[model samples]
Target: MDKRFIEEQDVIFNAKPDAVPYNYRISYKVAQVCLILAKSCWGKSGCLPIKLHMISFALCSKEAMDKLLIFTQSEYAEVPIVRFDPAVNSAVTFGIADGLIFQGQNGKYALTDKGRFFVSKIEKESTVLSAEKKDLSLLSTKLTDAKIKQLSDIWRNIYAED
Candidate 1:
């Protein structure tokens, strides 16, 4: 976690699109992993708070979508960060229904054997996926439910302003 995020009332979710081509085999956006884990009749992503925050963070992160440039300032340096987007959550549900993501006991989402095989194949075949796997791994290691909730609050504040 960045110190600034903890110290400041405002937090930035720098959602820039990665250069990776879609992993056509998986055919889903990134944020749905949380849903894949949570909606399962099994175990959830640790708990409701963890599930929401983790998925929400993915939806707002650079790994999920590329940012578009808008010149709100004379220096052409303004960038928009998203707070929360429902579409991602819906997509996650769809992923679960479609069998791309599965939930076992406790609601923790595990990639189906298919998903695992697809990832393995993608890692071997796609440079972009390889990089994303790295990014996802790093992000996964660094979050807790509390931290995610903090970030989610910041996102909601921005969302409410609109």
Candidate 2:
């Protein structure tokens, strides 16, 4: 109705079909890292929490019935709920539960030896963890190839497997 509103609508209309804010890419990156770490440390000893179960179940449902979809008409649905939290939280929370990391004396979260073994592909120049290593390398390269070397050690330590 107003001049400012009209201009804003015009910009939205002309934007690319899949356009998203920069933060979306960054958050998506973080989500991927979390999933990778979780899969690396996967165990069948326990069940996933309700939120995770719902998201997983919904994601596999009929497209129109999928609550996890970006767009949904259900009254209980949130326009964009349940992404960064489950991925990131499960990574850290399960890491602790699985003895993959611990709180150091200095209050820093440090990876346990078991955790370090999982991400060891980034260091020690080994090819044993080929799949994981390749995935991590590609992801880091996408983020910034120059800095991946600098970050490799830290990534290996933080994302080691069970």
Candidate 3:
């Protein structure tokens, strides 16, 4: 019922109709990163310096961090969620979690003004798209009860196979 669902549905339909389910996962993951960045920006000069170990602990895996970083970067490279490698002297980019640790002395990672701006953009777009989907669902009302049940059964079976 959330607005993000609408946007996610729209994204699925337009960008990758064949992978509707994946849209849900992608939206949830992006939202999670937004929340994490928001929380980290709560104090200080809107910056939070977090260690890679802490991020790994929080997310439960380095792979998750990697995926999240990739997703964030792909979606918003200009206002990226994380910095690249900080531990080494070289300039290697890592996930946001890893970047937090490497940021300059006060290098803690915080959402840039632009990053905060995008949070609302993402949320709003998601909500609008989801709302439109709900509107489309109304078309199903014309279906017979039996047809609805059959479709439901088919979906259930398809999902159960996994």
Candidate 4:
């Protein structure tokens, strides 16, 4: 159509994209994982299966919680399907690379000393992640690996049958 308009469109297409938002940044996600581990781990071990981490992270979202609450009260009586966010793996990898966390042979992730210190800082702030901290605290150790796996199996079975 118009030559100048085509050139302008090309420039727009080549422009650099905006930076990832603070909530999606790896450092911020690492902090979120560490806080989750600190609050939700069953014992002093401060370790959790990766799948459970996904669940806990999903629970941090108000939307996810609302859907879960409604699902629990519904008559279908089926296992709730959780949406797994793949971005969490990057945060976990960054934590391991930075020595903030470690993955065990048992496939569980536990915070290192440095990670604990980082989480302590986040905790002391009281303003950052306040809502997530409160939600995770209320859900401490309630979402176990076994329970997650059971739900996953049910989901797979239902989908597989269809």
Best of the candidates, TM-score: 4
Off by over 4 Å in 3: 1-31, 43-105, 123-162
Clashes of each: 15, 2, 14, 0
Q: How does each model score on TM-score? A: 0.43, 0.27, 0.29, 0.72
Candidate 1 has its poorest 10 consecutive residues by lDDT at: 3-12
Please provide, for model 2 over 51-143, each residue's C-alpha lDDT reduced to its tens digit, 9 standing for 90 to 100: 233333233334422333323223333333233344445544555665655545543344555555534423444543344344444333122
In candidate 1, what are the lDDT values of residues 59-145, reduced to their tens digit? 345644232112111233333344444544564565556555565576645556544443444444444334445444444433344
Candidate 3 has its poorest 10 consecutive residues by lDDT at: 84-93
Winner by TM-score between candidate 3 and candidate 1: 1
Collision count of model 1: 15
| Model 2 C-alpha lDDT versus the unseen true structure | 0.36
For model 1 the local lDDT of residue 27 reads: 37
Instruction: State the lDDT of candidate 3 residue by residue for 1-162, as single tens digits.
Output: 322322322322235556555323444333334434444334334333332222312243344444434433343322212332233122113223333222335655445454455445554565633432232233212222333244345557866776
